[model samples]
Target: MTANETIHPTAPATEIDASCKLPLLALLVGASIWLVIGSVLAMIAAIKFHAPDFLGACPLLTYGRVAAAANDALVYGFCLPASLAVIIWVFARLSQTVYALPLVPVVAAHIWHLGVFVGIASILLGNSTGFAWLEFPRGGSILILVAFVLIAIPTAATFGFRRDRTLYPSHWFLLAALLWFPWSYASANIFLVSMPVRGVAQGVIDLWFGNNLLFVWFSLVGLGVAFYFLPKLTGRPLYSYFYAQYVFWTLVLFGTWCGIPAGSPFPAWIPTLSNFAGYLLIVPVLGVLIITVKTLAGAPVTSSSDPTVAYFIAGLIAFIISGITLHLVAHNDQLARITEFTWFGQAQTQLQIFGFLAMILFGALYYILPRVLGFDFIFPKVTRAHFWFNLLGSVALVIPLAIAGYEQGSHAYNLDAALPALRVSSMGLLLILIGNLLFAGNVLAMFLSWKITLVKSIFSAVTSPLKAVEVKS
Candidate 1:
């Protein structure tokens, strides 16, 4: 057998881990790098939200471009890759099989980053297509599609090669995610950008794409991670595991139809149906909450100082809140009018993207990275700081923005409530920036620590042979 095949051959799980280590590291490191870039741009965008003239001098840093660039970087660069890394790792573990060609994911990771860079650069250079999430130009979008398909194909192949054919909930969710993204993304690009939809139809398609990619693609992976970790970390089997099927089905089926803008120019029934679907989403959202609480109820894992618990707990709660917000917002026209085109809507997106999805990824990384690196975390101290910084920062952004929305809406554009809201949100953006920096720093520190350890081992091996020969002489 080749040396590669023998890698931790005695343990099936270790072999899978060994096979995935390099790809996981590469994807995760790229994700962290993009996190810093996104956070910087996000801060800039948040500043411009109220100030508007903060970077007025620079065309490249215009509010539209900067905000769009930040959104793309966070969604495509950081969140997508980070989520993909977790999906890949969890899928492999569930399959109970080692990768036959690990290089597939490593190469795909590089190409994916390249595509994200291209998309962000295109947006900055005034080439944005002006679609919400499908802003990437044709070239960047195509690159992402191709790269994603490369990974998607392998994901399906891996399923066929699994040692365990009985699927877990995580497996089901991952499979759905693998299928959903490419379809939704390609359809959006085609209808919104490439072929071009006319009038309100374009808006409808864009909303459809954005909502699916979030509620379906991102949510699937995030919940898959949550479901896997909640049980695994607590050393308990998932309570009501059967209900997970209901959660997954409801999300994919109902969640897809729920995002039609409340005031969309479409037929009244369309919007009404969407509102009904939004209300139906309560089932799965509550299911996830119940499952998580029951799984971790009375478990000592919650009390641990690992920082992962903080992220997990925060992410799960935020998800519930975000979902509840969506459900009611759709049913209430008055509330929708208040929120539509307001910072309150943005706040909810942040809660879902940053507070729930990104936090889940953060927790997963805290657990996954150490295992992939084959070492316990060397600098565990700053992780707690990382959690607090991000948590507080996210709160600062969400709460004030929601208030700002209310102030602007309730007061008929009066600046009374907007004033304090802007100030506090700006401060929140700064905290978010700091948290991203700390996360990047920790990832780098861990990588460097691993490299140094590897180098010392190699040096000691070389010197030990020389010393033995000299002693023999």
Candidate 2:
């Protein structure tokens, strides 16, 4: 690849990078800024579990508020925008077209981040809607929905104008994600926020939205990313290509019916039905694991040198672990009795979001950003550190929480048991805080490096004419 190929390449893949460069860069930069914000709040929320007085004086920093704010920031601010950016790039590349209506995403990026900021602020300020993922007030939720639609235009356009007719495995996932989120999000707002579902049905609707956003979107976008990049980075054809459709169909079929806890006040039949669907989901999870493992089996040793590979594998492991954990808790009556509403559930969430989803996105960003920015990573070594801290921090956080939750449950939620569990989970929280600091600092470093390079290029361009005039004179 020549310099031109890196920045202005005619090849379809690099062309895709160029076509969507400006919009995608904006989204990622926004995502990074939010990650730092959300990570700090999450750490604060975790600490309050063990040390209630950590920020006791400030009503604004209460555990409930901090946790909700953190969840909103990470999900809407970081994950959604970053995920949409990935979809845009993949869709364009696969469709073999320069992305159209790029301005829509650029505008959408501003609106989306604004919505996230306002929503998070609302939660911290005690104006949250009190719905799980829909804690954002009506105004914030509406803005977010509008912004999402705007950002999606280029994706829809690319697919419509595609030069390529045959769909790849990833196309199914990305396309499904593209079509699903808008309907799901819009309907949730209509049923839950705007009109308000009567009584218990509100909870059902919220769970439907939240679970779909978590599982369906993750399966579609996150796994879509893995499907594309794993074989790509490793230089191998995808293994078990035939099963790709099965994984897609099963997860899409069942993911929304998950997340209703056992022994909920809702009708017994509802929880039973949801749990059954959750158990069946293991089939798709195992399918993803098998195909991914087969592809990585004989992968060249040098592929691991990429650093992103480590993140990918760690995320895959986390995904499988979380999936199996979900299946077991749903299947075993005794296990649900012990773990329901405990830190065990929270552990499962962290594994799915930070461990599985975030790690996979981190890997994707590391690969995509350089091509879009037209520069090599300034601190390649930082990624190595990032990987270790990320892996260790997630392990420290999830494992301890799971044990704590179980111990707390075993002892029937006694203060003595709670105290010990809190202490253990707090240690994990501290490790996660350190890891987030590294991530934030590295993002800052990368930004500075890119800016410095940009300034030098401009300064040299401005001075070249004067140098030529002096030589000629």
Clashing pairs in 1: none
Q: What is the C-alpha lDDT profile of model 1 across 385-460, one tens digit per residue?
A: 8788889999998899888888887877676667789779878778877888888888888888878888999999
> Residue-wise lDDT of candidate 2 within 225-292, one digit each (tens)?
88888877777777766888888888888777888877888989889899998889899889888988
Task: Write down the TM-score of every candidate.
Answer: 0.92, 0.92
TM-score of 1: 0.92
| Candidate 2 segments whose C-alpha is farther than 4 A from its true place | 1-12, 302-304, 451-473
Clashes of each: 0, 0
